[model samples]
Target: MADPTTPPEPNESVSETEIEAPRSRRRGILVAAVVAVVLIGLGVWWHSTYSEDTDDAQVNGHLIQVSSRIAGHVAKVYVDENQLVKAGDPIVDLDPSDYQVAVENAEAALASAKANAAAARVNVPIITINTGSNLRSADADVTGARATVAQAEEQLDAAKARVEQAEANNVKAQSDLERYKPLVEKDVISKQQFDAAVAAAASSKAALADSRASEQAAEDAIRVARERETQAQAMQKYAQTAPQQIAAQDAKAKQAEAQVEQAQAQLDQAKLNLGYTKIVAPADGIVTRKSVEIDQNVSSGQNLMTLVSLQDLWITANFKETQLRRMQAGQAVVVHIDSTGKDYSGRITQIGGATGSVLSLFPPENATGNYVKVVQRVPVRVDFTNLAKEDPNHQLRPGLSVEPKVRVK
Candidate 1:
């Protein structure tokens, strides 16, 4: 509630003095401006003399997708996300029970096939022996039958001679009986003598009958011998088919061998499948995006993680198409990493066939209305040489922002 305006004293005027304050502040600001100008000028001169022409780029490498080759529950995961690994390192282990069972089954099948083959081989000799024995028996029977036929033929010849002799005796006996009867009627001889002659004649006639019966028996024996010989010949014919039997056995053996080979192939396939249970790193790299965990079930070819190979790294620079006029493969380049403030030496490796926008998921339709011309960007790949000598530990990685400069000359 004091008076709004009042006259100031000499002391108050002394406190409010602003004589050279604005001048001092202006001079300080001017000096700062001059120093900034000098630093900028020095920087421009240094860049023009030593710095290389650079374009915005990124570090790129092979992005390998790791997956399971067989279906099983993951028993163990040896690696974690973002972990570094070397080639042949085990990454995931699947339950090997199923594969082991398959291998065992295949092995059993192979053994069985081998046993069958061995058995078939043994049968070869057995069949040969049996066939040989049968043929020998048939041959012996044929020889015996031929001997019997010869013996029967000799007996028949003897019996025929005996029959002729008997017929002549019978003729003599009939003539003697007629003469004795006439003698008895004429009483020229005694009755006893005539009776004796008649008895002798009757006995001779009976002997003739017995000889005829012997000849008939000899003929029947010859027929029997011939029948026996025919039976032996038929048996010999059957025995002579040993070669055909051997051929059939050989075919069976061949079939068994083929089965063995087929089983062996299956065993090999099963072993290969078993090996798939242990998923290992394909190459030396850094692992990322590990999706598998212990006790997790995975199917064949399912994505498990990614491997970024650090052995080979390059830079992908999206340069304006106009800048490509002077760029070519094999040109030396300078790559500067913004993140680490490190410099790398490389060379141009490749150039894209089309612009970046043209390969985009949704490309710009220039035919549509409101088309605004834009400077197209072409991707250029710059590859590093002597990478192992530079960083053997693989410190450089993909997706790192870099500035790369190419020397046209």
Candidate 2:
């Protein structure tokens, strides 16, 4: 053996260039790997610095509950589950026969009330005219009766004067007759003179009787005139109530008008009830959770269906509290829907006022001194900016999972 520790002799086929080629190839691969890693690190840092992403997001929309406003037996159901409907489209129909009858009855009542009011109004003027005429006539009668009583009083005074004159003449004639009787007994004068005295006395007595009769007749006339005056006064007292009667009539007319108004109100209410029998859609949406059926008896405010409005939809993203440092309203957002594998453009509308755990039914209490820190999530509302353009078919529904990315920078 030549030297045990010495190297063996080199072969001529293995050149020095071949030995150096392995080292050069290894160096090229190592340099390329280092460059690739550096580029990837820079790209990741840029993404993290400029944007925020969260998978705790979902699509949300308005879920309107459709119900009956009045109690009735359902006669028709116009929509099925998942059916699209426009605002004011008929959704259900209740039996309208009862409402129709109510409307008819109300109309009849209103007509009756109107007729009564008309009659009462006509009576108002008539009563006023009649009462005014009666009052005027009574006043005229009272005046006339007073004049007749005055005339009767004057006649009574003249009759008394005539009675007094007649009595005086009768006394004088009787004295003369007594003197003639004495002369005739003594035969000192002619009998004709005594006879003349007797005739004068008789005539005077008859005149006195006639005067007394006239006085009695005058008293009777005065009594009759006074009675007429009393009658006239009574008539005036009755006519004095004419104004009160007219007012009462007017009041009756007003009451009738009030009744007419009440009837009109009732008729309007009946018409409204009739309109309520036809249930219509409140907005444009897709019907779901249909619980009403034909011939089913539904009470007032009973749930008939649920209407999901896809036209007004948004995303609710639960973001970590740490991610909200650079987030704010009106920031641009990209929503990736997991169900549809589609991306929608939106903008941040609002951020929650409190964390999800604090808003929960049972919030955690850390005051017991055994506190463990937790990462809390805050709800963020993102409203689509291009919903009409991207989702024309309205396929995005509520409660769909989504991933949202916000460009915070």
Best model number under TM-score: 2
Considering only N, C-alpha and C atoms within 3 Å, which residue pairs clash in candidate 2? Answer: none
CA lDDT of every candidate: 0.88, 0.93
Task: Score candidate 2 by TM-score against the native.
Answer: 0.70
Candidate 1 residue lDDT tens string, 1-409: 6665765588567755675677888999999999999999998876654423545678989999999888999999999888989999999999999999999999999999999988888888888899999999999999999999999999999999999999999889888988889889999889999888888789879989999999999999999999999999899899999889977897888888889999999999999989999999998898998788999999989999999998778889998887777678888888887776877788888999999999999987767577677999888888887677766667788999999877774
The sequence of per-residue lDDT tens digits that candidate 2 reaches over residues 280-328 is 9988899999999999999989999999987799999999999999999
What clash count goes with each model? Answer: 0, 0
lDDT of 1 at 384: 89
